[model samples]
Structures are given as C-alpha cells and as structure tokens.
Target: MPVTDYQGSTSSPFSFGRSLLSLRRDTTAIMPSGEEADLEAFQRHVASTLAELLPAADAGAGDEFLSAAWIRRLLEAFVLCQEEFRVVVAQARRRAGAQLPVAAERMVAEFHERAVKALDVCNAARDGVDQVRRWERLADIAASALGAPGEVHEGQLRRARKALTDLSTLLVDDAAAASGAGGVASFLSSHRNRSFGRARASPSRTAVAGAAASASASHFRSLSWSVSRTWSAARQLQAIGAGLAAPRAHEAGLAAPVYSMGCVLHLTAWALVAAVPCPDRGNALQAHHLPAAPPRAAFPWAPPLLALQERLAEEGKRKDRRHSCGLLKEIHSLEKSTQKLAEAIDAAPIPLFGDRENDVREAAAELAAVCESMRDGLEPLERLVREVFHRIVRSRVDGLDSSMHNAD
Candidate 1:
C-alpha cells in the first residue's frame, strides 16, 4: 500500500493516524533508554550550535524583532528555524545549566540577539523584498549552523527555509493560505493523540509537579532535583522560543518577545543567588527570597510547594458578586491592561531592561531584611492563601475534604 494513495476516505488508516496525533498521547514519550540518550545528545548539540549564531544577531539588532517576521520566513524557506532554537535552548538550559557556571544565567541575552536576526530576515522576505541586500552577517551565522550536530533548531529552520524558497519561486499569492499545516497537523494528529478522551485529571498534576517534588523531597530527592533543574531551563527556553517562532503580530501575545514574568523571576532569583552574603550561614539562606527550593532539606519551606500539598485538603470559595450589572467586568478588564504591558515589553529594545532589573535587584535585597523584620504578619496570610487554594482545588477534584483524615 503506497500510503499516500488513501486520498478520500474516512476509513483510511492514514486518517486514523491523523486523529491519533491530535490527541497527543505520549507518543514521543517513554522511549527506550537508548533512544532517550540519543535524543538528549541530539538536543545538546543543537543548543551549542545555536549559541554560535547568537554573536551575529547581537552584533546587528540589539533590541528589535530584526526586520519584520514575514520577510525572513519568505527568504529562509519559511523554516522558522529560530523557534526550534528557542525550544532547544530552553531544554538545554535546564540540563546544561546545572553543568555550566554562568552560561545559563546569561543565555537569555544571547537568545534575544539571535531571535532578532532570524525574525528580521523572516519579516523582510515575507513583505516582498525581492532581493534583500545580501545580509552577510546572517549568512555567516546560518553557515556555521549548517552542518553542526548540536544544531537541533536546524531541522526547524530547514523546513521554514524550504517554505520560504517555495513561496518565492512559485510567487504564491498567499503563502499562508497555501501553508499545508493542516495536512501535516492531520497526519501528526492521527498518529498520536492523548486528549481524544478527556484525561479524567487536572493538568495541575503536571503543572504542580515542581511543588509536589519539593514537598516529597525526602523520598524522591534525586527525581525531584532532576525534574526541577531540567524544567527551570526548559520552560524558559520554551517561552523565548515560542514567542518569536510565530509570525510577528499574528499572535504577538503568545510569542511575547519582551521581558516576561518568567524572565523577571529568573533574573530575580539569580540575583538573589549571587546576592547570597554567605552560603554557610543558615540564617541568611533562611532570609532569602523564593527560598532556594527544598531539594536538600527534609522539610522545605517552599510556598508553591506547601500550597500544593495543602491543596490535598483546601478548597477556594469564590466570593459573592452582587454588582452583577456588568460590574464584574473589572476582573477580566485586566486582559487589555495585560496587552499594553506586554507591548511595552516587546517594544522596548534589548538589554530589554535596565532600571526595572535594578529595581528587582533592590527588591530581592530587601526581602531578607523585610522578612526578618516582618516575621509572621504575612506568614499567616501566606498560610491562609495556601490552605484555601488547596482546599478549593482538592474538593473540586476529589469531591471530598482532603483534610478529612487530619481532622481534629
């Protein structure tokens, strides 16, 4: 059976595969140990290669999307190479961060530069720049990544590049209209799907994995440590990569290019780490912000963590709203407010932050002093929020009081 000939029927096995891909069942998951090792190595190679390309971007555009999005995609074969790089780097940071001294902390700046170049070229090409001045700089970066093994994003870039070439050669009226994402989506969708039937579970199981890991550290310190370290880097890379991957302005919100909360948290945490007066002193470590995660402690005072276990029992109760006359719009009104803030982030150029970062630095510094002086005033507030949110979640999911066993 020449698999391609299943052209028109719902009963086609090909169609069935398409359906599976959409469900996203851990198809790529749980691969054999050997395969996992190979995959990890392949990813590492990509991360390092991408790093080479950053210098070029840093040289050209410090804080901008480079050119526009459309033009570069048009020129680069529509490969959207940078997006893959983003994903790859994010993963690399987590795995490699533990190993690298300062690289993990500083990689974001490099990513900002690389994204600017790739995105610039993509936008320029899409907007009808018939023959762009040969960007010798981009070519240099692209050249280095051409045959590199660590070039994980290379595959992504190649596909996008092919699309760009095809669009230019064919003079496609609407490159997007012709984008065969649906077919590919269907194919992948059919081959692997997990959400076909609702996973009778909350995503928080995965979302709160960090919290849970921190909570049960004694029994699973090794597993928790590995997951936490890996996720921190992977998640950051994912954010930056995904932000620039999408066509500019298409879904700017999703591909948010500017400094995000994640970036803030990351830098803040690191600054706090560097600000640590002395590691040997238990008192200062206790006074630090976000509390250095509890991997080593038998019982860590991790807020998000404590919140999760507390959720085993607590349930949040929504407050009553009597001003039902559209007054409730205020809660969601923040949507627009969020957009402006996001735009402010994107519009601002790289070294995307200067004073705000300093502000955060100052804030982190004061946290220890403030915590020492403030003591338990807000601690009860913190505990209350933790207990309530958890109770609400547990009761909603389990339909019974999680704290029933612990009742007085």
Candidate 2:
C-alpha cells in the first residue's frame, strides 16, 4: 500500500520495516520542488515534509527509535549549513557599497535571527539524548521481561542506568560552574601551583607549574575549537560592520559590538566549565594541604565577567530544569506502561495444549504490545526532532539562496 494509505489506516503494532520505508520516502520528498520559489511555499513544503516523517503506529519498528547519533549528525549538518549562510551574507554585505539595499538587508537580518533560533533548537535536540536513552531502557526492560535472555538485558540496563546517573551529575556540576560557585577550589589550587612554580628553584617543582599552565592552555584551546564556527561567524559579521558606511551600519544594529561580545562571553563560560575539575577530582585534591595563594589584584574586567558568569549559570539551570521536566514526563509514561504490561502478562491465558509453544506465542505478543506502548509515548519527542531538523535546514537554505540571488 502507498505510504499515505498506511497513515490513514487504523493503528496497529509497530513494525521496523514499514517505519524504515516511510522514512526513506519522506526524506526523498524533502527536496525542494521546482515550483516552490516563494518563501512561504518553501516553508510549507518543509513543514509538510517533517510531518510526513512522524512515526506511524502501524509501521513496525517495535525495537527501535531514532538514535542520538542520528540527531547529532543532523545537528552537525545544520551547523555547517549555517556557517555557509553566514559566509554568503558577509560577502553580500561587503559588496553593498555606501548604501545598503533595504530589502536585502532586511532579508539577511531575518536570516541571521532565524539562524540564531535554529542553533537553540539544535542544542535542545542534542540535550534530548537523555529522553531517548530513557525510552531505550524501558524497551529493553519490556523485552527482557517478555522472555528475552536475562544476562545480556540486565547488563545493558545496568550500563544505561549508570550513564544516566553520570549525566545527571555532569549537568549539575556544569550548572554550578557556569554560575561561578563551583570552580573556586580548582581555580585557587591552580593559582597556588602557579605561585609555587615561581617560588621553587627545583626543576621538578618548576615542571609541575609548567604542566599546570600547559593543561590550562590546552583546555582553553579545546573550548575555543568546539565553538570555532560561531566565533568565526561573529568575526565575519564584525568585519561586515567595519566595512559598511557608519550611519548605515549603526542603523542596522551591526555597529554595536553586542553580538561579538555575546559570542565571546559564551566561549568564556564554556572554557570555565571545561577547566573546572570534576567533583571526584576536586574532592581528592582538596584533601592535600597546601599554602593558600595570595589574592591576585582585581582586574578591571572582573565585574562584567562576574555578571556574565551569573547569567550563564542561570541559563544552564534553566536548561537543566527543562530536561528534568521532560525526563519526569517520560518516567511517568514508562510507569503507566509498565503497570499495564505486568497486568497483561498476569492475565494472559495459560496453555491448554503445548506448554512451551503457548508460552512463546504469548510472550511474543506481550512484547509487541509493550513495544507499541513505548513507541506511542515517543511520538512527541520524534516530532520535536523532525521539526528542529526541518527549521534548521530550511532557514540555512533560504538564507543561502537569498544571498545568491541578491549578489546576482
């Protein structure tokens, strides 16, 4: 049957084959149609394509859901496309002479706004990995309960539970560090090490200081590299502003250094988070006695840095809270489904005929039902992933196309 027919049919058990086939068809349909030149039409096309990709109830994929790896790849693609769009916009702005074209400028500015929003969407989707992992655990539990081998399934569940615990700890630490409250011990310890290096004449002591500096430098480099695309884009925008006529640039909000400053602050907070020692390491280090380093002279930039740190911490808290709420919802759904599964298994009819054959058949049916329940719970999350992918791709493509047209 055609894919559309499957969509309208009564709900049925999940099937991996049908889900895969539908996804293939929907992805193919996302390509731009020749007639969709208008912006609204293009957006409609993208939205429809995304909607089409939603998981189907009758589509059999009982054991599978979208993977975090797949979402990461999609986000990477989105970021690369945004980078390309930024390049095109910068080039166009540079070529615009004394007076920028109002329409072109507006279009480009809108594109910039959308690109920023797209990044937020992508980040949220990336964080949704916890939700995906939770669903996977539930499915594994259901399978194991329905006669899957105990040893392998138990091991998988144990590992998954451990990962979730680690993730929660990391998020809490990250939120604290971002807020400036969590990293003081590590910072002070590193500072003391630096001071000791200056005081000690021994080669071994000096080497320790050098190693600390090297480690700090490496951490900074890694953090910068992680968001290098955003930094590069910000610089390009700054360059465009520099080249524009002063009045025009100021009117465009490009003259203000806010965008660049925001990017730098973001990078700084990320670096701090990276530099802070994990709780375990910090606890271990604090056990050793060392002389306190003399307080360093206050920097002129200290106030602003403190404020930025506070803001970043707040943002991190908000994100963590959001994820927690989502996780709670998932847990609630899993609980309900699990209760139902237990009831179904208890109520399942005993074999009047062949014992082994009846047990296998009943177990398989119960497993399928459990899988269906899990898939139903995941529909909202799957839709969210699809929508984010669509928005990012659509915005970047539209921006690139607009820039190219204006250049012509």
Candidate 3:
C-alpha cells in the first residue's frame, strides 16, 4: 500500500512518506515531480531494508540475531539509506537552486553535525571489535590447551586455567567500569602492555623521564586510536540525539527526509554501541537516549525496526547479561563456553574420567567454534565501520563543496 493510507495516525511522521505528494496537490511546491518520486522511493527502500533484517518469531536457533552477521547487514542497510538520502538531498538542492528554504538548510546542517558524532561512534566500535578479537585470542589459547590429544593432563589444564583467569579479569574489569565503579582508564590499561621502545642513552636522566612521560601521556590520551580517554559512547549518543525532533511543518518537504535520516543515523549508532564493547557501553542503551520507537501505524518500517530494538534491549536486560561487556551473540556464546569449560576444569577429579574428560573437550571445541566465527566476521565488520566513517566524511565534504560552488 502507498504510505498515504496510514496518514490517519499522528500528523507529522505519517506525513513523512507522503508529504511531497501532499505539498504538490495542496499548493504550489518547489520539489520537481521526479524528485517527489525519488523521496517516495527512499522511504520504501528504508522500509524494505529494515523489514528484511527482521527474522520471524519462530526463526531457528541458527538464525543470526544480534550476531556479527546481523550487525554487518545492519551496517549495509545504513549505507544504503545514506546513499539514497544523499541522492535526495542533491536532487532537492539542484531543483531548488538558490531559493532553498532556511529551515531545510538548518535541518541538513543538523544532520551533518549528528553524522560527525556518529564517526566517533564508528571509531569506538572499531576499537571494540579489536577488543573482542583480543578476547578471541585468549579463548583460543584456552581452547588449544584443553583440546590437545591424549588423556587430559594437569599441565595442559594449568595453561587453560591461566588463560581463562586473565580473560575473566578483563571481563570483570569491563563490567565494573561500565557500571561506574571504575572508568575507561582501568579497562584500557589492561590491554596496553608495552611502553615506549627502549629510550636511547640520554645525557640527563630527567630528560629521559620527561620524554617517557610525554610518550605515555600521548598514548593514553589516544586510548582507542581515534577517540579520547574521556569519550563515553553514552555521552556521544546523547550529543547526537540532543535537540532532535520531527521536522517543523513548513520544513517537511526536504526536511522530512533529513529528519528520517537523522533518526536512522542515531538508531544505527546506538545499536553499534550496544553490540560492541565501548567505553560506558552499558549505559549507552539507556532508553531515554534511544530514538523513541516511531508509531507502528505511522511508518511501514517502524514495526521491524522496533522489533529489533526491543529484541536487543531485552537481551541487554537479561539477568545474566546486565553486566555483559557486549550484547553480541558471539560474545554471549564465548562467555557461556568459557564459563562451562572453566567449571568443568574446576570440578574434574585428578587424571580425569570418561564424561568429565569429554566435557572439557566438548567445551573446548565449542569455544573454538565461537572464536572461529569471530575470526571470520570481525575484520569484515570493522571494515564496514570504517566504510561508514569515511562515507559520512565524504558526504559532508561533498555537501559543503556543493554549497560553496552554488554560492560562487
């Protein structure tokens, strides 16, 4: 059905999909009929993209919900929406020429600012992916130690226990930091092992100490490479959502798509912060900071998007997950396998028995599989995040350069 049929809901968002047609029919309008077609197409694409991401309620256990593959698909959808919006914005500008409304300009400008904040989110998420990789390595160590052939040996168990211990420490620290008991510094310090390479023999000890301190300071300040030590995913999301609202009445023509894009941007970024381990990752899912679920009746895409949001939120709230470093499905699988393997190691009698030895090996095999999946998925996921970051940059630059050319 054409989205206009849903116009009986709230006036603003429902008006979003059909606003161009309303403007064309009710009054003289600036958007060309062809541009109106493009806007409608954009909304429909958004709807279909999100609809495809929603798995059925009875989806099999193998379905990839909140998994790395699912997140990749989400990023793909974001890229598609971004590409379509870029076209719509460019077409609107070309048609309007020098007479573009001030409100439309402001809406686009606001979206640009939000897009900048999302870049920081992408950077943090990349680091988070790196963090998960670190965990995967530790799990691989444990898995290898336990999965060795022959009877389960004490020496092998010792190595596996040590790896699990270190993994536990990191996980616990992250949980504590996310809850505000500690902050990102402690969490990052756990991962940073090396110092500045050996200082050359210096004439003065004081100079050497100063240089070392400077290097350490610079390194710590740039904790996640691109984000600062103080950068909180929670605060960054809040910054992106601040002052965001539906487009004002007069601005609904071009402004409506701008508003829709802003909402998608916020939702996508928020979902990344939830799935990946970021500084203050736990608090990033706070409901108030989330884009309020658009009315289901108001937009065709609302139901599926909201379904996914609700599913993620429910996962976050799961009793075992409240303190989880991340809500990604593989992370959950990793944690479960590690815990079970740890328990098996702790409970086993000396020289190991049939079921007990089998348990250890089984658990090891499961953990290894989880690590393998992460190995295959994370690099691609990080690449997608980087793509998102650069795409936003290119769009902003193109928009600014276009405006300058028009002024000239």
Candidate 4:
C-alpha cells in the first residue's frame, strides 16, 4: 500500500487513509468515548498504520519506507501498545465475566500473544547486533596487535584473528545488502511530518484525554528527530565499514585487520535496526496504569564501574608501550558506561504527553534526557575506538613495510 507523504503531495506506493489524525477522529463517534475508547481507537489506528507501512510481502524485501530503521521502531512500539491494551481489555472482560462474550475473550488473548511474539522477534534481531558488536571489538584488538611484540601466543592470536575476520566479512555483506537501496535522506523527506507530542512532567489525569490526543500526534515527530540523529552515527559506521572492506595497498595478509573494522560497522547497522520503534498508540488508562518509572536510586553501580575504568586507564598511561592495555581500558570504560546507561533507562519513567498535569509525560521526558546523555557519552567512545583501531592498523602496516625493506 502507498504511504501518504506527510509533507509533500507525492502519493505513496500503497494508500493508507489520508492522515493519522483524520482517521483517528473519524472513528471517535462510533467508539465508546472515554480512556478505554481512546486506547482502542489508538490501537486500531496503529494496526491500520502498520498494515499500510509494513510491506505486504517479506519484511526483508526492502520497500523504501518500510525498510527504514525508524519505520521498524514505529511498528514495534505500536505492537507493544496494542499488546498492553489487549491485556487491559482482557482484565476488564474477566471482571465483567458473564457480560462479555467468549469469542471476544478469545480474540483478545490471541492478539496479546501475537504482539508478544512480534516483540520477541524484534528483540532477538537487536541482540544479534549487540553480540556482533562485542565480537567486532575483540577482532579489532587482535588485528591491531598482529605484528606487535606481545606475550600472547602467535598461534592463538592468528586463530582468533582469522575467526573474527571471516565472521565480520559475512555479517557486513549480509547487513549491507539487506539494508536495501533507500538512502536516509529519502526516508526522512518522505516522513518528515510524522512527529509525536513532546512528553512533559505533569501531576494530574483529569485532562488526559485531550493531552493524549495531542501527544499521539507529537510523539512520532520527536521520535523522528531521535531516529535521525542516531542514523547519522549509523551512517558514519557504514562508511567506515565500507572503507575497511575495500582493498588497499599491501593488503595481501591484512584482510583480518580490515575485516575486523568492517565487523564493527556491520554490528552498528544491526544495532540501528534493533533500536527502531513504532508509533505511540497510547491512551489515558494505559498511560495512568502502566508501571511507574524506576525510582531515584543511589549510584552504587556507577562508582565501581567508573573506578575500574579509571584504574585501567591509569595503568595504561603509566606505561609507554601498553597500547593494548590502553585499548582494553577504553573498552572497559565503554562497557561500564553502557551498563550505567542501561540502568538509568530501566529506572527512568517514560512520559506519554506534554501536559503539565500528566505525570507520564514528565517521566517520559526524564527518560529522553537520560537517553540524550547516553548518546553524548557514546560519541566520544565511538571516536576513541575508531582512532585506536586506525592507529594499530597503521603501526602494524608500517612495521611490516620496514621489515620487507630491511630484508631487501
């Protein structure tokens, strides 16, 4: 089905109803007129939107808009929202018992299970990316130390290097091809106006319906901004990966090192795919009843993680030739940082609307802030990792060249 351009008049390949707002408002009269009604309406809108946005065939086929990371995220979020709504509906039906039809009960259960399965699939794909990233980093370390004077056994290093290189190459080729032909620029242009409401800190629920309506509209817009920023990082990684995969001068025995870098890029691409979520199909009841965000806790984990990272870094700085140690320290720091960020995410609340009366919005804003901070921290780590790998590769190549000239 053609998607309606949020900005331009250009028709999408598949047709969905005019705009999300119009479709949602049109059905408001036919549906019950409260929080539950809004949620049902939102869920229907999301399902219909997904039906339109998602490819009619295989997800891997690479339809221009459907293939985008943001689109995937939007779909995932919609599925989650629907799942949550179904749970509520089931619970309410159980309370009403004899009043609700058996068929209605069965249908609700089925929808909930389907949503769960979809979420699991999305999560598994995300985990695959994370696993590949860890391996890629390991490969970088091994490749960088190829010709360096180290106590590590040559045989073990060579074996590890070969394994990492091969795996990296395979993963990169697959991801690059699977990503399809659509560029980020084209995707952004097509869906520019699909923003959702800005979540804010609020303390009441009396006006939640009005707030939810506005929030439903703005949430995607905010998400689009977040996704676009993340895409920039993904693009950088892809470019680097492409360079690593390219043939270079004196490259005969150095495929492992180059492929190691490529692995990082491929892993990054997969991570981007994992991070995408669908549109926000939230309602007042779900927003009010959902679990509260994590409580503000002491920084127990941060201190220890930071201490270890600092200790490793100090040890590396004290020695002149501990480049490997320095790299290890950097890796440790990144790991610690990642852990801290994850904890923050687990504890942070997600806001559902921008209204001051809605506490959900406040929680959501806090979560967004933490995420922004995490992104800031990751930028430096990414740069450090890239520089370390480049330095190691360059030094190794220089060493190999010098040896050849001496032999001549």
Q: Give the root-mean-square deviation of each candidate in angstroms.
A: 30.4, 19.5, 11.5, 31.4
lDDT of 4: 0.31
Off by over 4 Å in 1: 1-83, 93-101, 129-408
Candidate 1 residue lDDT tens string, 1-408: 112322333221112112333222322242233433433433333233223222243543321111122112111211122222233333433454323224333334444443332221122211211111111112222223222333224243332222222212221111112121221122222212121112342566433433332343223212121112222222232333343221234422112222222222222222221111111111211222222232212211123333322321121111211111011122112112222222232233323246543432333233223223223222332222222223223222221221232131
Choose the strongest candidate by lDDT: 3
Better of 3 and 4 by lDDT: 3
Sort the predicted structures by TM-score, highest score first.
Answer: 3, 2, 4, 1
Better of 2 and 4 by lDDT: 2
Stretches off by above 4 angstroms in model 4 are 1-40, 43-72, 87-99, 113-127, 142-164, 168-408
Give candidate 3's error at residue 92 in angstroms.
1.2
lDDT of 4 at 70: 26
- Estimate the TM-score for candidate 1: 0.17
Against the true structure, candidate 2 reaches a TM-score of: 0.29
How big is the positional error of residue 227 in model 4, measured in Å on the Cα after superposition? 30
lDDT of 3 by residue, 60-161 (tens): 544478888778778877877776777677767867885456667767777887898888898888888887887788889989998878887877876676
Worst 10 residues of 4 by lDDT: 277-286
Model 3 reaches what TM-score against the true structure?
0.79
Ranking by lDDT: 3, 2, 4, 1
